[model samples]
Target: MLILTHTLYLNRPEGEIPIAIRIYRPEPKDGCWACTFEIDWPEGTKTMSGAGLDALQALVISLQMIGIQIYTSTYHHDGALRAYDNEEGYGFPIARNVRDLLVGADKIYL
Candidate 1:
């Protein structure tokens, strides 16, 4: 079942794109929750996921992975004008900001 959903905007050279992040429920694994985040672009879509002890951590980890993609995609489009470095936490914060909305169906803790 779907636990929660969030959206983030990534700055690409072509323009801005909305990245949809989602979490699914499957009980739990090793006491951690599972989540999957997807980045959809005009070219295609890429998926990344993570498991965490709680909902927020799961969301954060998944977001971090998407952040890496955002960084790489931005770099691919225009390396010189990219916003933040991969080491600087990439688009994770950008994704996490969606938490302010807290629009999940379950205990997402987002």
Candidate 2:
């Protein structure tokens, strides 16, 4: 069982929403992880399942269903933080310190 918490700003009228996500891996079959997820959102609860290389990938897809995008970047020399805004001139610091870069891919949920 892998658990993650994320605060997301939705485009809907309700605005920011806090969600609790849980991923469960029953057993590996044929060298693949069979993952299922349970999302506890403000509105209600939802569950889903899919096949992924790992649990993280499965979580990414579950979040995408609610309009969240998760990904990584290799453009920077140190391979900038995952989900950092890649758009030109967005006001994010170009040279981020270890603390900021170490935030991890989960920070995108914020």
Candidate 3:
């Protein structure tokens, strides 16, 4: 089963909102990835966890397709939903922790 812990609520421009995130660590087997992530949510809020394989896979693939780089251990690239090609000399790597998730590599604009 997956566990969701260490939840924190933040006041954003969107008003008081609940944001929960989990770090997914995947293991490759039979060309499919498997792993668990640490989820964080509000202490008193109710959220769904560990639903179904189809849904989870869909969510993960969606996240990846949008360039949200999911890391295995915060140090290595488990895999990317988007393809990164370096056609220029600007050496931009995807391992820069959330960089690829939020902003495309610096070389993207170069």
Model 3 TM-score?
0.24
Please report, in order, the local distance difference test score of every candidate based on alpha carbons. Answer: 0.53, 0.41, 0.35
**Can you rank all candidates by lDDT, best first?**
1, 2, 3
Q: Who wins the TM-score comparison?
A: 1
Candidate 3, pairs of clashing residues: none
lDDT of 3: 0.35
Per residue, candidate 1 scores C-alpha lDDT tens digits across 10-98 of 56668766656555653366767767666565567666667788877776777656554654465334533222334222234325444
TM-score of each: 0.47, 0.35, 0.24
TM-score of 1: 0.47
The C-alpha stretches of model 2 lying farther than 4 A from their native spots are 9-17, 29-32, 53-110
* lDDT by residue for model 3 (44-108), tens: 42222222245456345433322222232231232222223432211223334545434344436
Query: Which residue runs of candidate 3 sit more than 4 Å off their true CA positions?
Result: 13-15, 23-28, 31-33, 36-94, 97-110
Better of 1 and 2 by TM-score: 1
What is the total number of backbone clashes in candidate 3? 0
Q: Model 2 reaches what TM-score against the true structure?
A: 0.35
